[model samples]
Target: MADTKTLAEIEQRIAILRDNLRELVEQAAGFSGAANEELTADRINEQQAELDELLKKRDAMTKS
Candidate 1:
């Protein structure tokens, strides 16, 4: 079970992750190399996974 403080912290992290993904996509759009695109895609995937996990955790916490 998570306390209110923990839930708030999770929410904050989720927001930050979303901002990071948006910025990464914008930067990727400007880059022209295949290697840069691949690297950016990998980073986006990792961040997306993290955001998904946090979203799940937040849902579970709220349901409890």
Candidate 2:
């Protein structure tokens, strides 16, 4: 019950992060300047790292 709920929440967060990553990529493509590009790239890396961690957690939970 609780585990299921938590898993659902995590899944929801993962989906949102994926969407954010997509938008970030698009924004990076449209934007110019080294500073702006670096900022966007940093954000993308953060989101991707978070997404990867969440995926690993979800996988472990499912396996359990």
Candidate 3:
């Protein structure tokens, strides 16, 4: 069983990831440079994957 502290930390991490992902998406949309755009797109994908994992972790913690 996860303790309340651990659960809280997971929730906090989720929130931060969500915020970061949102910013990355917004930045990617406006990015114009070809090379920079590609880099930004890659970053967006990476952040999205991290967000998904954190969400799954949070769900599992709550369910247990």
Candidate 4:
């Protein structure tokens, strides 16, 4: 079973990831060029994957 501290840490990480994802989305939306747009899109995808993983981990911890 996970301790309270561990759960809190996971929740904090999730919050950070959510913030990062928001920032990435905003940046992607603000872009008007072509060269850097691909890079920004890739980064958004990566952040989304990371956020999804963290959410899964948090769910698992809570279920235990």
Top candidate by lDDT = 1
Give a tens-digit lDDT track for model 4, residues 13-40: 8888889888888888889788779888
**Worst ten-residue run, lDDT, model 3?**
54-63
Ranking by lDDT: 1, 2, 3, 4
Per-residue lDDT of model 1, residues 1-64, tens digit only: 6699999999999999999999999999999999999999999999999999999999999999
Report the alpha-carbon TM-score of model 3 versus the true structure.
Answer: 0.85
Backbone steric clashes in candidate 1, count: 0
| lDDT of each candidate versus the true structure | 0.97, 0.96, 0.86, 0.85
Please give, for residues 1-64, the per-residue lDDT of candidate 3 as tens digits: 7688988988888888889888988888888999989998888889889879878888888888
Pairwise lDDT winner, candidates 1 and 4: 1
- Report the C-alpha lDDT of model 2 over 9-43, residue by residue, as the tens digit: 99999999999999999999999999999999999
- Taking all chains together, each candidate's TM-score versus the true structure is 0.95, 0.96, 0.85, 0.85
